[model samples]
Target: MTTKTSDSPLPWPPAAEQLPPHLRLMGIAAAKWVVQPVYVLAKLGAADHLAEEELSTAALADRLKVRCDPLRRCLRAAASVGIFRETEQDHWALTDTADHLRTDAQMSLRDFTVLLGEAPMWAPFGHIMDVMRQDTPAFDAVHGQPMYAHLAEDDELARTYHGAWSSLTEGVMRALTTAYDFSRFATIADLGGGDGTALRILLATHPQLRGILMDLSHSGEIHQGADRAFEERLRTVSGRLPDDVPPGADAYFLKNTLHCLSPDLVLQTLRRIRSEMTRPEQRLLIVEGVVQQGNGFDWSKLMDIEVMVNNGGREHSLEEWRTLLSQSGFRLTSAREVLHPQWLLEAEAA
Candidate 1:
């Protein structure tokens, strides 16, 4: 079956800025609690079961083999957040937003929700203050290892982490491909392209373009199945950045990869990519969340905190991005906001 695709995300929740000062503060403080019920709903596969048919809380609880009262509360909490709806006194049905929570739904966030609630990802936030004080990532301080190293040691966590990213990439690729002209580049290399979701989309959209998927190591698993035709035009390479970059691509992509690295590492990676550009026409495209200025509501501002806590990385502003690119022997050519806060930054060797 052809899975549905979405180029844009669901609308953001109503802003709390309109509320009274005390109520806004209270809502801000209580916001963290909201994820708990949503996590429970995703963890329980409630959306999948609900997709079969709307059922009363008692019946749904029995079907899921969980306590009725707690399940009912979770359903109600989720409903309050627009994830579900209570049709009758106890009857519940999936909302349009809830449909994306289903495991089989295209670009499903079930694993992403699970990842958010998992201790490795969630527990670090509680120590954000400590992390800020020490200049160490909370994930490393709490887990005794870097996030990537920890993932390497835990198979289940690694699957969920990669799966969450892959699912997210599927949703974002449409916008990225649409915003940027990939047809200009004959062969594009996706550095740190996990599971080749972005490449698949690029190749599918621009039929004449070929792609190289380079990562730390190839997982040998193609998401959503790349047929023999796609395989004929795509090549997978196992390598790390600042050293193992594949040569001969017309353009290179570093989507959502640089933000996970330190400033020095980002420079090194970019310098290496700059050195690898044999032709003056070769370009480097970076896709990342660009943190906006001011205290206004920007998703990247919140994501900045998440990355700071989870890894020693950050979302960069437009000025910071230009400075970084200049320092790495590259010139920032263009930066377009393709998917809300996520920007497509095009650069070339200085």
Candidate 2:
């Protein structure tokens, strides 16, 4: 007798949606409590241990050689945030998101998660006021040295840092290879190419192009499944950028490298590259997070704050890129969207 409608209000305000403003704010502020546990699990290889089957927290603790209670508590907290699942009390299993934290997982972010837990990296978030009030970088203020310099002095930290970057480059390389054409260039020189992954992808995708991977230190391990035929075509060179970038490459790919430096250094680097150009027809491909102007939000804007706190570097708008290129004696010819949040700003000598 009664016809039920598809859209009907069960209650004026659902019980779950009735959280008080302060409690909601508290949940937001308490995010670190959730993430820290996941970081611990990542650092302890818990995901890899759970990859095979669901296990009791006691089993995971035994494998990791830590106390059971604390580990169980951590797992429960992590489960609360969907990283892991608690099938029952004290029993846990990996979720889809948690599976990626496994060391052997493709495009694993475990190293990056570990780095996020490191004091030198996460400490900056607490000192934003200081970073804004003074010219001193938050990382420098907290750690007594710039982030890069600090990493240089500690081999372990440096390894973790580069490993994190390698993970990111690996994840983005597919998007990049598909978005832009490398066949037009005879040789592509990657500036600050960590682990040579990006260059390898480009080389494999475009057989016509050879690549030179340049970095401050040639430490990143070559890709596991690198094309055997293109092995001879790939080369790695080590040196500081803008100065040490291999000369005369048809196109220079500076992927996410400029955002790590100050504007002055970026300009100097651009000028140095400009001087190295053998022909006016050559291009300088600046691959970076070019912030979109206006009310919309983008990851680049958030990263700009992180860069500010860590190294005083700032992400730029397209107009800013155009200005920087023009000032460095190059003309911004084309800004190609290579994947979301990344752009390839192609420029020629002005």
Candidate 3:
């Protein structure tokens, strides 16, 4: 089946190849400190305050209850990166980029920013050397627990972590709904669908289709809104992957879930889904980024590093995808780019 192609614009911070060799390397080195200011701004909720009106640094600092001088410096650093703008002496306003940092923004990045800057997520990067030399994830080394397990113990952190994923998934779901045809499947199960974001988009897009959203027990509260909205057509199940797959759906989907798992786990998860397929016609759709084959810059390569550090998971190339699916008793039928770096791979029981 044919799907629409992406017209999305290229991401900012221009590609490394666009710059002179020396400057490119220098920019890469300087990038380490760039997120710090933005993180501080997000943590302070500066963008929310700025949304009402431009304010002097002193007033903004007072509202946020932080030291005026350091807050101003942080604002200046963020302004330098186009996140905010200094309108006049000591007065700052939100730039278009910074507006997305507001909590009420339709596409908010505030939680995602805070998540990346938080100690549990950021401190692990320092142990990347350990991840490389010893095979232990930097996150495990730093926190002595897996990322999800740590989140389980901290309710506030869990909210931020899941909220950040929900924010990130919203746009991806929009892209996916338009890029692939789901009308063919009368029912679809979103395995490990966090917060039911994808199912919300899919069911909204194709009115004829019903959906099952299966995630961990902790996601029950998160699914309440979706449950209320589409009460009749939607089913919410508390379950984990590589098992607990409910059967009898026309198709099953795993979006942004496999990459968070180890290879064996991924295989087991796929096999579990395969076992639940009662019909030969039942399909499986995997939505994730495929590592490109080139020396060129690709975002998936960068995400691969994050996955490695955080959970010992990984991004896969097309070859790797084929092998995994084959081992799990499915045949890859089509793989198309729905968004830059993200692909929609359709497979059927083999």
Every model's TM-score: 0.91, 0.87, 0.91
Question: Which segments of model 3 are wrong by more than 4 Å?
Answer: 1-23, 226-229
lDDT of 3 by residue, 197-226 (tens): 888888888989998989887876665655
The TM-score between candidate 1 and the true structure equals 0.91
Q: Number of clashing pairs, model 1? A: 0
**Top model number, lDDT:** 3
Q: Check candidate 1 and list the clashing pairs.
A: none
Worst 10 residues of 2 by lDDT: 1-10
Off by over 4 Å in 2: 1-20, 218-231, 294-297
Per-residue lDDT of model 1, residues 1-350, tens digit only = 21222223322243555566677677667866678888888888888888877789988889889999998888877777677778767888877788888998887999889889887899999998897589789999999999877876888887887878888887788988767787789999999887788898899999999999997553556544668899999988888766778989999998898888878888899888888897899999998988887888898888888788898888899999999999988999998888776789999889
Against the true structure, candidate 1 has what lDDT?
Answer: 0.83
Q: lDDT of each structure? A: 0.83, 0.79, 0.84
Residue pairs in steric clash, candidate 2?
none
The residue ranges of model 1 lying beyond 4 angstroms of the native Cα positions read 1-19
Error of 1 at 38 (Å): 0.6
